[model samples]
Each structure stands twice: as C-alpha cells, then as structure tokens.
Target chain A: MATKKTIAIIGASGNMGSAIAKSLANAPYRILLFGKEEAKLKSLFKEIKNTNKKADAEIIGCAADASWEADIIIAAVPFAAEKDIAEKIRQVATGKIVISISNPLNETYTGLVTSSDTSSAEELQKLLPHSKVIKAFNTTFAGDFSQPVINGKTIDAFIAGNDEEALETVSDVVRSAGFNPIKAGALAVSRTLENMQSLLIQLSIKNNYNQVAGWKILHN
Target chain B: MATGILLFQSITVILYYNNMYEVLFENVSKKIGLTKEEEQLLQTFFIPKKLRKKQYLLQEGDVSKYLAFVEKGMLRSYTVDEKGIEHIAEFAFEGWWMGDQFSFLTGEPSKYNIDALEDSELLLLTKQAEDQMLEKIPKMERFFRLLLQNHLIAIQGRLASSLSNTAEEKYNQLVQACPTIPQRVPQHMLASYLGITPETLSRLRKNISLRK
Candidate 1:
C-alpha cells in the first residue's frame, strides 16, 4: 500500500475539530491533532485512541509544527482566529491543502460577521496566497459527524475551492467522514455556503431541531 | 505464548461465525435462485450485525438507516405511550424482516423502537444498497416486490384482527401462524402485541387449555 496522507487539524480540542478527528479516526490517514489547550488536546487524543485502537494520530503542541508535516491542514478554529492561524502557519502551509471550516456568525447568531462582499474562506485564501484554501463543513453541524445519515439520507458537505485537485481531495475526505460531497463551485461560492449555514442555524433554533439538522439535495 | 495462541484462535472462530451469511442466502434462495457469482456479489450489499438481548436496533426520533433481516433469534418493535406503557407493534423471528418502514421510506424520524428480544444476528441493507442491488440483479427486484406484497397482506390481516378479533381469537391466530412465539416471548409482551392485558391473556390461555 502507498504511504497514507497526513492531515493536521488545528484547534483539535474544539467541538468541530474533535468531531472531524473522530470521524477520520478509522480512515487511512495520519492525523496530527493540535490545539491551544494542551490538556484538551491530550484528552481528545485519548478519546480517539479509545474509540479506535489503531488510529494513526498524535497530539502536537503548535499549528505550524503540525502543518509543516501535513499534506492537508484543516483550520478547525473559529472564524475570528482564522487570520491569526493563517499568519502562524503561512510559511509551512504553502503548496498544501488548507481547508477553512469556520462560519463567521454575528453575535446575535442571526447574520454573518464578515462583510457581504467576501467569505471567511475567501479571506483566508487572500491571507495564505500560496496555500490551496478550500471551504467545507461550515454548513454541517458538529453533532452530525458521528451519524451523518439523517432520516436515511446522508448529509451533504458543500465544498468550494479554486484548485480542482484540492476540491476533489477535500471531497474524498468529506465522503470518508460519511457525508455526501457536493462541489458547490469555486472559492467564491463559499459565501453562499456560509449564508446557507447561517440560515440553517437560525431555522434549527427556531424549530427546535437541537442542532441535528443537515442539508441533502434530492434529485432524479 | 500458548494462552495468546488460544485467545487468537477463539477470536478467529468468533469472526468466522459472525461472517456466515448462509441463513441470508437460504432466505433469498427461497424467493429466487442465484448463481454462485451473484450470491458473492449480493453479500457485498449487506452489513451483518449482532445485538445482545435488549439492545436497540432503532430508536424513536432517529431515522431508520437500514431494513434488518433476522438470521437468528428474535426482535420486537414497540412504541411507548405518553404514560410510558409500551405497545408492542410487531415481532420478527428468524427469516423475518423488521424496520420502521415509514421512517425508512419517507426519511423521517421514527415513532417506533426496534430492539433485540434475544441475542440476534441480522443482515442489514440500506436503501441505496437495495437500489443498486436491484439495478445490478434484476431478479432481486422480483424478490423484493414479492416480499413487499407478502408484507402488505400480513399487515392488512393484522389490522383486521386488531379491529375485530376477540382476544382469544387473536391469541389463537398468532399461535397458529408462529407456533414457537408463545414459547419464546414473555406473556406480557404477547399480551401487548395482542392489544390486551396480561391477565386477560392468561385467562384466555387457561380456557383454551381446559377446552383442549
């Protein structure tokens, strides 16, 4: 077998980060789990190991170190921390796939924090010009990772990236995590995906779905 | 080293036992014949799972992901009322299939709970897998249609019985259909399935024995 691809998850202690890590535990990938809180990272690592004894994962102290050794870097931190993390890992993340999974929701949770002109993913792309920035998983809730099939329908993960190869790679990762990957077009499409998630969040709150709702496009 | 080898051998045996699909193949063969190659291909579509007694296969408020065919042991589907009284919907024995069909078909949250009544082995197939299977093997399409027809007939009969039959008549009909069920299931569960109290079932059984 060929050598497994390495994926570094920044902010691996956070809800989305840990959920993604757990989802990919059984997949054929080497995982580098990093977060600001050392203790949380340690517990997350232990949790992953407990679930899958053969998980190829380890806790790393910093994002840059993890990104340097990784083929794919997932920025699982909040939208507010995206620029700070981009600056931290800019040098090493060049020529690698950097996935932006943050949604820039406003304080009221009724709107986007970012201006209507550009998305968090598009901004991240501008910040790390050399890295292939792909937007994905923002439309999905963290709880859906463990059981992506809601009502017998697999949840759809909308992916957007300028690089076709990067988009395909991210689609494969999303599929491996038990979601149906829908290529929602180029990096600019991330704006629409983010807005879609904001609407879904609002609806879930108003309707009492308890954050278990997800998207599934039905077609002939 | 000897103990380790014994442990490894036991695990291997368990794995081999779990992978056995003979029961599923036999059930399918009764409906339609398949070539050895087709059987091998068909095996890929199903996922084999084991549930200990009392383990839930499907729960209320969750979507039914797979339709399960019982290979061994028994399972029961039930719903709890607002007062916490369980109303048994149906029971699935060996060679029978069970699922929340409404939830599975419509992609909605189920109002039913399916759980193993005994330590059970089942072959589970998802809707996508079923569609692909029918596409690959046209013969399976007939098998499934026949299965659905039979299921509908049974359901209609059950509905009629629930509405019109006496408790005694219902118990007798159930026994006539599944002779082994009375022995396998608890009295209260059988009563619940008949939509009657346990005391009524007990009295009915006693009266029937006296008549015999």
Candidate 2:
C-alpha cells in the first residue's frame, strides 16, 4: 500500500479544526493535531479515538514541527492568528499545500477584515511565498460540517488556488469530507469566495438560521 | 416447497461459510501460523462478499474502501484513458489480493476500475478493521508486512520485465507465472495486458506451439 499522506491541522482544538478532524477521522490520511491549548487537543484526540479506534492521529505540541512533518498543512486558526502561524511555519511550509479556511471577518461579523482588493488566502500566499495557499471551506459554517448536507443536497466547497495540482488535492480532501468541491478558479478568485462567506454569515445572522446555512450551486 | 427452498438456502449458506473462510484462513496460514482462537478473532473483521461476472468491485473516481482477498474465481483491475481505451493493470485469481492501494491508503479517488472476471467470493478488509486485527494479533502485522514486501518485489519485477522484455518474452513470462491465465481470461484481455494486439497474440501462440 502507498504510505498515507500526513495532514497537519494547526489549530485542531478550535471549532473549525475539530469539525474537520472529526469528519476526516475515518479517512486514510495521517492527521497531526496542533493547538495552543494542550488540554483541548488531548480531549479532542480522545474524542476522536473514542469514535473511531483506528484513527491515525497525533497531538503535536509545536505548529512548526507538525508543519515540517506534514505533506499538507491547514491553518485552521482565526484570521488574526494566520499571520503569526504562517511566520512560525514559513520555512517548513515551503513546497507544501497550505489551506486557508479563514474568512477574516471584522468584529460583529458584518463584513470582511480583508480589503476588497485581497482575500485572506491571497494574503497567506504572500506570507508563505513558496507554499501553495488554497482557499477552501470558508463559506461553510462550522455547524454545517457535521452534516454537510441540507434538504438532500450536499454543501459545495468552493476551492481556489494558484497551483492546479494543489486545487485538485484540496478538492479531493473536501470531497472525502462529504462536500461537493467546486474549483472556483485561480487564487485571486479567493477574494470572491471569502466575500461569499461573509455574505452567508450576515444572512444567517439576519435570519434565524443558527449557523446551519451552507452554499450549494444548483445545476443540471 | 417452502421447506425444500429453506433446505437449499441453508446448504448454500453452509457451503459458503466452509469454503470462503477456509480459503482465507489457508492463505493466511501459508504466511504465518495462527492459533484456533486467533483464526476465529481474525474472521470477525472480514466481510465476505460475492460478485458475479462483469460486476464492478470498484470504479474510477470511487475510493477503494477495502483490500479484497479472492476466495474463489478471478477479478481484474484496469484503467480507461481519456480517449476511452482500456488498459489492463493486473489480474487476481483465487488467493490473490486486489485493491487500489493509493486510494485505499489516502482516501483519494482511484484511477483504476476493478471488476469480477468470473463469479467470485472475496473477503474484504477495511482499513479500520485491519488496524484492529493487527493490534489484536501482532503476528498478523508481521504477516501483512511480509505480504507487502512480497507484493512490492513482484511489482518491481513486473516493472523491469515490462521495460526490458519483448512482447513474446512478456507472454512467455506471464504464462510461466500463471499457466492457466490464457485459458481463464479472454484472449483479447490477455493481449491487452501484454500490450499487444489480439492478432499478434494469436500469431505468437501459434508460433510457440509450432516451435514446441
């Protein structure tokens, strides 16, 4: 058998990270969990183990160490922490796919903190110039991950990356996690994908959706 | 009539239970000795499935969730290119294992398609189940490691032969390895596997027999 690809989730104790981890628990990848809070990481690891005894995962203490060992690194932390995490793992992340799922929402969650000119993934690509930064999973709410389906339709995971291979890889990961992956375009298209998420969050708040809302493109 | 039907079904079940598990156990025994208890424990993790001829075991774009151990009959793995030409990858007879290892290990879509060439019985092992079995029986882990090593060697040898051998030499090697393949698989399929035309394979066969 070919060796399993290792995926490092930098903020694995957080809502988005844990959700992604749990969804991929049964998948064949070797997952490396890294979080600022050791206790939270431990509990999350335990929970994952309880659910699936065969989950190949390790609770890594250092983000850089995890990034160094991983084939793909996911920056699952908040937008504010993405820059710091990027700096920490910049050298290790070179030539690897760094997934940016952050929306960079401003306080009150009304709008994006990133200027209209650039998306969070574009900024992350600048931070780790050698790493292939792919924008994905930003439009879907954390709560929606558990089901990834609404009214018999699976959620659409819009992915954007400068590297074609990186985009394909992220699309595979997204599909494995039960979402319908839509390859939006090049990394620059992340600007629109990120804004789409901000709009979804705003609409969900304005209504009473309770974060259960997700994006799905209807087609024949 | 109902009683007769019930008796027939029961007999079929009994035969299935005896043959499939026995084949798997015998195969494992060839690699490493297993105690009766260990044998019983190992059986719990495998799921027995049957496929009719031409039924797909796996398809392109689907993740291979199980490593199938052939208990009876034959199966083949192949790929269809962009132009829709089918390229045969490997064939599995009884006691052989078949799977898209990359897809099975990484949860990625397989490029190959596996389908039964004959009515077949298979014992399937999922990644999770295999892990539990290995943890429960460390000896099985060694057995698997040896199996993998042997598989690797065979694949490497095949790669070398494919690169260096002529079509006739390749056919000779294939028949030397599995003498029954020509009779078991369709001629065209065998020709495809050897990267030759059916006409060439027929010509080669006639020449080989004439030489003999």
* Candidate whose DockQ is highest: 2
TM-score of 2: 0.53
- Model 2: per-residue lDDT, tens digit, A37-109? 8888999999999999999888888887687667689999998998899877775565578999999899998
Best by lDDT: 1
Interface RMSD of each: 19.2, 17.6
Model 2: per-residue Cα lDDT over B1-212, one tens digit each: 99999899868645645565777888889989999999877876765555658867788888898898998989999999899988999999988999999999999999999999998877778787789889999999888998899899989988988899888999999999899999999999998898899999999999999999
TM-score of each: 0.51, 0.53
lDDT of 1 by residue, B93-127 (tens): 99899999999999999999999999887777878
Per-candidate TM-score, first chain only?
0.98, 0.97
What are the per-residue Cα lDDT tens digits for candidate 1 across A109-213?
A: 999989989999999999987678999999999999988999899999999999887898899899989999999999999999999999999999999988898
